[model samples]
Target: MKAFDQLYQKHYPTVFRVAVKMLGDSDEAADVVQEVFLTLFQTMEKGMVVEYPLSWLYRTTLNKCIDKQKYNGRFQKLETAPEGQVEFQSIEKQETRIRVQRALGKLKPVERALAVMYSESLSYKEMAEATGIRFSSVGKTLSRTLKKLEAELKNKKYELY
Candidate 1:
């Protein structure tokens, strides 16, 4: 329990962020994060060794978010988590985030997660370990996802520049 506390404290924010990036809704992201932690707790209670704890958490979070997204039957418009009283540096920054998220919403859930992590600059090796994607495919998949996202944005006149 003590160790779980420390682990949750360290990783919860990352899980929550990934969930939001994948699902585009803070409300749903919160639920997915809770589900991930609950699963972790249960798995640990069964004495399972988490080979790579962070990777496990990320993969689990992505799985739960995909499940939730499927259950909801539709995508929600992306919005900031609204973690009470947080301020954006500028309206331009906020708009950019929103536009990118809108483009992301058009992707399949796995692609959205990969694309978001790519935008965050995670290495292909890290993404592969976390998501169980082939390390070699990560680059090709990301390139395709990004090109698709770019085309979608272009249709909406939201230039990445």
Candidate 2:
């Protein structure tokens, strides 16, 4: 119990940020994090030993994000460009964001997950472990997914030029 509490305290912020970055909603991110901890507590109660808590948390958070997106039918919504003071000459940024989100929406769920994990700088091994995919497939899957996304983005009509 004490150890679990310490783990939660130390890792909660990282978990929440990962969720938010993946899901694009602070409220949903919070929900995902809460669900993850709740599940962890249940597993611990069952005497299950987690060898890698961080990896477990990250994987769970990603799964929760996928589930939430599917449930809300918002899997297609690209995360809005970071909100803050940024100089922009026009609505190009917003249009680009929309275009990207639409293209992301076109990807199958697994491809979307792969792209997100890859973009987050997760290594192939880490991505495979987190996604429960083969380590050898991670590199190829990510490469294909990126190419698909780039192709989709380029083919879209949202040109800033």
Candidate 3:
């Protein structure tokens, strides 16, 4: 219990961020994060040791987000802001973020997951382990996925600066 709490404290924010990046809605992301932690808790209760908990968490979160996206249809447009808070980002920055997210949405689920993992600065090894891609293919696959994302952005006239 103590160990699980500590792990949750350490990793919850990362999992949630990944979920939001993948799912586009904070509410949906929060639900997915809850589901991931619940799965972990159940696994622990079953006396199964997750050798790499962070990797396991990432894998599970990404998988859940992909499944949710499939079940819900296309990735929904993210709300510009939460109610009642002044939007502080420069207009250019906000536009860039929205453009990039739209490009990300154009990718297949696995490709989007790879791109998100890359954005998170995950290593090829970590990405492979988390996404179940072959270690040798992670770099190649990510390179192609990134090119695909770039093409999607360019098609939308969203230059990457």
Candidate 3 yields a Cα-based lDDT of: 0.85
Candidate 2: where is the Cα deviation over 4 Å?
74-100, 155-161
Arrange candidates by TM-score, highest first: which order? 3, 1, 2
Winner by lDDT between candidate 2 and candidate 1:
1
> 1-161, model 1: which lDDT tens digit per residue?
88789899999988888888888777778888998999999988898878788888888888787788788776764534345423745767666666777788788887888887786678899889767789999999989988999987776553544
Candidate 1, 49: how far from true, in Å? 1.0
Q: Please list the C-alpha lDDT of all candidates, in the order they appear.
A: 0.79, 0.78, 0.85
Model 2 alpha-carbon miss at residue 158, Å: 1.4
User: lDDT by residue for model 3 over 1-161, one digit each (tens)?
Assistant: 87789889999999999998887777788999999999999998888999999999999999999999889877764433222232777767666667777788888888899999999999989899888899999989999999998998787563545
Question: Which run of 10 residues does model 2 get worst, by summed lDDT?
Answer: 77-86
TM-score of each: 0.84, 0.75, 0.89
How many clashes in candidate 1? 0
Name the candidate that leads on lDDT.
3
Scanning candidate 3 in windows of ten residues, the lowest lDDT window is 77-86
